[model samples]
Target chain A: MSLDQSFVGRTYPPTAPYQVGREKIREFASAIGATDPAHHDPEAARALGHPDVVAPPTFPVVLTMAASRQLIEDPALGIDYSRVVHGDQRFAYTRPVVAGDELICVNTVEDITSRGGHEFLTTRTDVTTTAGEPVVAVWSKLVVRGEA
Target chain B: MELPTQTFQVTRADLVRYAGASGDFNPIHYSDRFATKVGLPGVIAHGMFTMALVGRAVTTWAGAPDAVVDYGVRFTRPVVVPDDDTGTEIVVSAVVREVTETGLTRLDITATCQGDKVLSQARATVRTAG
Candidate 1:
């Protein structure tokens, strides 16, 4: 089934503030084997001008994925979680996220289209500081595969 | 010019670690049964995991942890990670696409697993360390 076309361009309310933690950044960096000192050593990050430990480029997904649950589990939108596969991901950064940042996500449904019995839904997440500093914009494409 | 290639190994263990760290508890990354039930060949690595590996390569090339200003990728294929020790390998290769007057460097990236390109349209813009 195709996604609700009316949902396109619908923007959701901002999420609660998510505190970016030092330990969490370390864990994320280690999980991917990113051994750059700036990801773990606050002093190293400070030398680079970041306020605290710097997160990897894809780290925002950690929070944005959780924030996007608002749409995926929307009873009205009715997305099948089991049949979903990721299609594309993009991140444009105004600045790299650091450990001390308090981030919030605003999710918007950018587009929805169906082709070849598959439905594609693109969601753009605008991540910012609680103080409204734009951090980065993340875009994700989820494909819902049709049963044969 | 092509940057030096980097190779990273992905195992079910790495996926589990990533899942816990990223809060993505998708069964497809850990349970082969659920993966095949959903018509997948086997437990697959998370798309984000693969992207993170590529990000590591980008930063390594730029010599800075916070170098990436922009990054993007299209998941064209799954990296089936086995439960064994040497599960799978992702090879990342990139070429310098352009250097802007503003000092930003753009790279066209490629990630392959088992000889199949797993990510397409992969690219990154990084502020290289002077």
Candidate 2:
């Protein structure tokens, strides 16, 4: 089934503010096997000029991916969550994320295409502070595998 | 004070184990033929798996298990894992970029395979205990 092309440019409402926390950063880092002091130690991070412990680059996945539910669950979009497989991901950042930041995500469906009996969905999520400061933009590609 | 970097060889066993743990079963990551057919030089590791290694490097330094709050990366290139004698070696590195008032720290990160930067412009945010 083809996706609703009309949704390609639709922008969803801003998500509830997500407070970035320190321990959560540590957990994400540990889960991915990151062993960098800057991810947890204030002194070490301070040495590098950061205001607080920094998160691993992949940390946005924890929230943006979760926010994807808004689009995936939308019946009008016709996305089949069960058939979906992550195809690729990319991030563009104006600055690194830090704890104490109040973030809200705005999701947009960038494109929809079909090839080889498979559907491809591309979504972009923008993370920003409540004051409208842009932090990062994440683009994700999902492929819905065909049933043979 | 100093950037953290580590290099280690990845084995087929490591890839298989990560696949099981992460629940990602892309044939190109495990099947040589599938990988070759898909135009990869050989089976390649999952980008997230490599990213996971970067996270591990950070957590090891943080000394805590659950401190990461924000993380993001751009996949500049794919890590092509060849079916050869030497396997693959991945190097992970990070630098402290900034500190925040609420005890949050930010880092610049990178993931390289051999000499190529498979992932670039990576950054993360972690919080400290109050």
Candidate 1 Cα misplacement greater than 4 A, ranges: none
- For each candidate, give its TM-score against the true structure: 0.98, 0.62
Candidate 2: lDDT of B120?
A: 66
| A45 Cα displacement, candidate 2 (Å) | 1.4
Kindly list the per-residue Cα lDDT of model 1 for residues A78-112, writing each as its tens digit: 68877889999999999999998999999999999
Lowest lDDT 10-residue stretch of candidate 2 chain B: B59-68
Candidate 2 residue runs with Cα over 4 Å from true position: B1-47, B54-130
lDDT of 2 by residue, B5-90 (tens): 77767767667766654445678788999777756688888777777676666655565434566665666676777666677888
Q: CA lDDT, every prediction?
A: 0.94, 0.75
Instruction: For model 1, name the residue pairs that clash.
Output: none
TM-score of 2: 0.62
**B1-130 per-residue lDDT for model 1 (tens digits):** 9999999988889999999999999899999998998888999999999999999999899888888999999999999998898999999999999999889999999999999999999999999678
